[model samples]
Target: MPELPEVETTRRGIEPHVTGAKVREVIVKRHDLRQPISPTLSTIEGRKILSVARRSKYLLFGIDDGSSVMIHLGMSGSLRVIAPGEAWKKHDHVGITLSNGKQLRFHDPRRFGLALHFTLPPEEHPLLKGLGPEPLEETFGVKYLRSACSTRKAAIKLVIMDAKVVVGVGNIYASESLFRAGILPQTAANTLTLPRLKRLTSAIKEVLADSIEQGGTTLRDFLKSDGEPGYFRQKLFVYERKGEPCLKCGTPIRHAVMGQRSTYWCPKCQR
Candidate 1:
């Protein structure tokens, strides 16, 4: 799945090529993804692209006609920039051919990705309205996280992974953050002291920032817009490293299910 950093990397990668370029045409191959592709996006033809941006796992291309085109690289999707002369891959599901002869292509073998056209402010868009604060934004301070998790009975790992608590702390990041903070995955949220919470908050931000720095961890079904595989997987401390030695302690990293997601943590190092 494309997490926040992967989505952000995609936004940065394609913006340079697509921005200021006029949309010459759009080709929709198979519209049904996680949701039905809106039929009106064909109107995006001829509009100048103003900007390309990302929020959470969603990407948006601002067009001159007061409308924007949105994309979500659901579990098994990838977007890439391909030259007009380049041959399309078998999984390529959609294409936005620019006036410059370059194209933005979406590839999804599983058809879980989505392409939609909507005119409402992104904030009010049904898909975006209720999202939590961005972890990398300055507004999401430790105090903000502390407040969000106050008195919760949920496991600390699950609490932090909740989109309503904070966006972008996905399965990989949640495990890495808790491992770094020395907080057990099953620790009750309300049982954490302020000091422990502070450490956990910092760990969350650090792990997320580090992942973004490495261009995001690409386990599978994810690729940067330029098609480069993210290198963060090499730096992982606990994610998918079941039974592997913990970097900080010799004990093997443990894996368990939390919220139905595989979670990794150092049993001895954490709590």
Candidate 2:
């Protein structure tokens, strides 16, 4: 699935082309996404897209009529901008033709993505309501993390991965952040002190910022809106490097399954 950085990268890449451009048409090749394409989705046609923003892992396309379109690139989904009559690929499920003469295509092989139109403010939408602060926002600082982790008995990795505690700390980034903070993934969340939590928070912010700067981690299903792979994967310290020598210490990286996600860490470097 595309995480925060990946979604943010898409938002940045497409904003310049889509914002201020009127929607010429809305095409739904299929209505069965993770969330059914809203029957009212066609209402967006002829409306200008005022802005494009990302919240957590969802992209928000702000329309002139106070309505918004929210999209989620699920396990195996991507968005591409191409010519109006370009040949559609097998899984191209949705397309929005713009007055700029370009079409935005959504491709999802697993059909697990979302394309929903909501008249309400995006924060009030069921999918977005109750989501925790964005990991890179000021609202998600050390103090907020400390409070969220105060009562949890779950492993530190699991606690941070909780969308209720902080958004966009997905499996890969969580592992990378913990490794950078010198914290073990299995450490109890509530057992950590304030100073340690502070370091962990900083590491999380740093890791996410670095990934976004690099255009996000190049996972199997993620790609920039321009169809280029992100280069952050080459900079990973511990993620997916099980049994490999640690970059900091000579110890071999260790791997385990926690919260049903593969986790990697350096036994000697990460306490």
Candidate 3:
């Protein structure tokens, strides 16, 4: 699934083209996705897009009337801007034509993406309510992370991946962040010292910012709205380097399953 950086990249890529543009048409090629397409989506037609925003991994398209369209790019989904007359490829599930003659197209090979409508105060929506603060925000500082981890005995890797703890730190970025902070993935969350938590928090922010700058890591089906694969995978230090020499200490990188997701780390370098 696309993580925060990937989702944010898509938002930035498509925002300028879609914002302020009036919707000329709304087409649902299929009504079944991870959730059934909401019939209220038809209300988007003829509305002017006010702005594009994001919460967690969902894209929020704000319209003139205060209602918004929320979209989640599932495991194999992507959004692209194409000319109205362009031939539709397989799995192009939703299309919103803008008055500017450009169309925002959603394609999800696995049909796990979503196109739904919501009222103005989208934050209160069940899907977004209680979501942890954005990782890049000041609210997600070391003190916040430490408090969230204070009572948890779960593995630090799993603890940080919890959406209620901090939004958008997915499996790939979690491994990379832990490796950078020199904390083992299996460490108990509450056992971490304040200094270590500080490092971990900084690592999370740094890794996420770097990935977003590189257009997000493309392990499989992820792509930027412009159809480019992310280049950050080339800069990965530990996430998938199992059996390879550690970049820092030259020890073989190790791999294991934590929180049911594959984790990679340098045994010598990452405690």
Candidate 4:
């Protein structure tokens, strides 16, 4: 899935093309994606996009008329911007044609992403209502994370990845963050000491910031809006490096499944 950093990179890449541009057209090449395209999406035609905002993996394009078009790039989704009448490739689900003759195309091979439109307040959207604080935001500090982890019995990795706890900590990031903090993926959330929690919180911020800077880890389905692969994958401390030597301790990294997601860690380095 395209996590926080990838989503943010997409926001940065596409904002210049679509932001503040009038939507002369809204074309739904298909009737549905992960979910059916709500009829309300048609209302965006001719409206001007004022700004673009991201929440978790969802992107919201603010319109001049107090409305927003929300988008989610599920596993294999990508967006490309090109001139009008550009050639459409396979799985090109949506095309948002702008008055400036530019079109923003949404491509999703699995059709697991969504684009929804609404005139209701953003707070009223079902997808946005209950999401927790963004991990990159100032509100998601160590003290905040500690309290959120207080009552959880699930593994520390699972707890942090919970969207209600902090949005956008995906599997790859959870493993990387725990590895950075020297916390085992299987450690129960409530069992973490204050020191570990503190370190873990800081590591989350650092890894996420670094990933965003590097344009996110180059997971198979993720790429920058401009189609550049991220460089951060080479800097990964443990994620997807099972059997590889840990950089700090020379111990081999291990992989395990937690909540159906593959988790990587260094047994000796991460205690």
Clashes of each: 0, 0, 0, 0
Runs in model 1 lying further than 4 Å from the true structure = none
True-structure lDDT of candidate 4: 0.88
| Cα lDDT of model 2 by residue, 1-271, tens digit | 7888888888988889899999999999999988799999899999999999998999999999999999999998888888979999989999999999999999999999999998999999988899999988899988888888888989999999999889999999999999999999999999998988999999999999999999999999888999999888999999999899999987999999998899999999888
User: What shift in Å separates residue 16 of candidate 3 from its native position after superposition?
Assistant: 0.5
lDDT of 4 by residue, 1-271 (tens): 7888988988999999988789887888896787888788878888899998998889999989898888899898988788778788889888999987899889899999998888888877888888889998899988898899889998999899889999999998999899899889999998888889989989999999999999888888776887777778889888888898999999988988889999999999888
Tens digits of per-residue lDDT for model 3, 63-160? 99999899999898999999988888989999999999999999999998889997859988999999999999999999999899999999999988
| Candidate-wise lDDT, in order | 0.86, 0.92, 0.93, 0.88
TM-score of each: 0.96, 0.98, 0.98, 0.97
Q: Higher-TM-score candidate among 3 and 4?
A: 3
Candidate 2, 218: how far from true, in Å?
A: 0.8
| Candidate 2 displacement at residue 183 in angstroms | 0.3
Candidate 4: deviation at residue 126, Å? 1.1
**By TM-score, how accurate is candidate 1?**
0.96
Please give, for residues 1-271, the per-residue lDDT of candidate 1 as tens digits.
8888788878878889999999898888787788888899899898899999887788988889889889998888888889866887888888999988899999999888889999998888988888898888877776887787777988988888888788888998888888888999999888888888889878888887887788888767788887789989998898888998988787998888989999998989999
